[model samples]
Target: MTRKQLDTDIVIAGGGLAGATLALALTRAIPALRITVVEAFPLTPDASADTYQPSYDARSTALAWGSRLMFEELDLWGALARHATPIRHIHVSDRGRFGATRLAASDHDQDALGYVVDNRWLGLCLMSALVACPQVTWRAPAQVRGVTNNVRGVAVQVASGEHVTELQAQCVVIADGGRSGLREQLGFRVDSSSYGQHALIANVSTSCDHGFTAYERFTDAGPMALLPHGSGDRAGHDSALVWTLTDDALERILAVTDEERCQQLQQRFGWRLGRFTRIGQCHHYPLTLTTVNEVVRPGIALIGNAAHTLHPVAGQGFNLALRGIMALVEQLQQAQVRGEHLGSLQILRHYQENHRRDCQSTVRFSDSLIQIFGLDIPAMKLARDAGLVGLDLLPGAKRWFARSAMGLGGRRPRFGAVTQEVMDD
Candidate 1:
């Protein structure tokens, strides 16, 4: 097991959530298999040098129940719990007309609606687990310039500071992100569309306690979500906002001083929390839907953002990635036990078939929701309002919808995902 850059049974090309999870799962399932993860971004020792940090990062995620189970299996939930906030209630509403729907934790007999955690914190937990997993190897600041598929396996040509080296593996998984450097190189097509909107995310403090209730208000500009932060919130600072709006509107809001922006938030958002007294650094991201042509190839497979990227309206992209990673591990484990070729085209084909339904469904769901709620047409508005009214009439319709938002409604993974955890560990 010695090669300058080669020799590995499984090579994962990205260290993001999906990649890390897949490596861990495979290692646990198949003790004999060796896994290596190549990442471009490494969690630095210095807090300031860290590109992703909990407090300052403008990005956070609404992890689904299924994803929560994945964290538990990887021994990350305990650490994640420290920085997460439970979503006790989700309030969905439209401005002007009183069309709103509320889903409370009580309806589901759960403590909260869902969990929201900072991406940086979650990533850190994952990295920590990776370090302890004996079957896994971590490589970072490495760029994959080429990939060559051979008779035995695939060869990954990496450019680590001008010195090129080849890493061999039976299969290569792409977890680089939505914009993967190796996606096109693997001969797959990707499609994307801008929503003509930008999302401005930041952490804010409020006068009143939100009590774990998250607000998904459909403002005249666009949809804005205010999710609660987990435990360490020290009472006063408890919420984070993901405000999406037209580019022009977003720019106008960003131009003003933080003082004015806080006021605007208060004006449009009302005093639900009295007033947003202070906001952390404001960051912006373009809202768009990116879909890849396929999830699997002969010697390469794509997971997470590399496979399909959707509008953040639902926040299921990352969760979906976790599910895919789980499934891939299951398939590889069975293949290994059966003495089957893990990197064979037939194997990936079957894996793709199992995940295709969930991938397409999630992408379509997010795209459809964005178009549906974003419409201001009179008839569409009437229809949407009527839909909400219908949902309210049904006792648990709102709760069911909330579960779907958690990414727990899709096809069950073969390894089996119960309620949400990996079935039978």
Candidate 2:
């Protein structure tokens, strides 16, 4: 295929949070490059970013402070911050144990350790931004049937309605998600380990205010987190819950009445935020630790959940994906400046090399939290208590923990700003 035969410079699979954000980053970094985003779900027609109203049971994501900075670079923080709830403090404790640790934003010299925003709102902001960029083309209610590497680049087969269209691009980015069929279609080897646990997610209101503090509690059963949710007057009164449970426990919980479920939750979480007065719609997801043997090929790259999926105990999934996005953009910018092929293996390798350490450390951090806390041996339990107490008493260790939770554990990558010329266009 020749230049004239190529449909776009880049093709992004799955226009969810990761895919959509990558599209915006690429357009801002390379003003002249043409890109196409293929998504399986149809977007809400005529959705206005300014008018988005989240539902009472809206799902939420925890954005690390570092992730906030990346959005600011993309000129999206202003819009996102409007609905975001700042986490001024984090309270972590082992259920029915004496081990506990507290982290404050003041100690880190920041306004917030992180922010919790509804996932729907975040998607709205990203989609709105993508629409304003002339260099991007979106294909929704469509599926990428297959992708194969060609001499000139990669050939992408996208199906919409009854029609199937084949498009060629310099690179294909697979951000379809953790269970990405596209990644497997390309023959990427994946290693997966089941935790034999499932997460029960829901939104709940408390009799007492949360004071903008997020809570993480560990029990013999599994780990549970309650993140501050909503904004303004509703902020302190409500929280988004992620409760980990065994298969049998999950079934029992789901079978109970709302009031009974709240009572069980209060039993596990204690009275930190008082009684769980109300519970919203509940969702369940199995816990798994998954990673791919290779994230990049000659003309392809894997990102977001497609590349790695972690235990939700630490809430590091999306934040880690954001860092990977920026790293890839940095390498692509360099490749563009050098007039090299965007899909060149050399360029893609550099991207992976820079991000490998961060990925490995994050995976270890999340998995370790689960393994260490999951142990029922008395000796291990004593050790865990000591470790938590020690972490609180040691300033250096506490600082490191704070940084890691804020997604600043590794070297930060620089993202290109949108040029004035492109802005004018």
lDDT of 2 by residue, 112-133 (tens): 9999999999999998888899
Best by lDDT: 2
lDDT of candidate 1 vs native?
0.76
lDDT of each: 0.76, 0.91
Task: Please provide TM-scores, in order, for all candidate models, with all chains considered together.
Answer: 0.90, 0.96
Candidate 2 overall Cα lDDT vs. reference? Answer: 0.91
Candidate 2 weakest ten by summed lDDT: 416-425
**Clashes in model 2: which pairs?**
none
Worst 10 residues of 1 by lDDT: 416-425
* Top TM-score model: 2
Residue 167 displacement (Å), model 2: 0.8
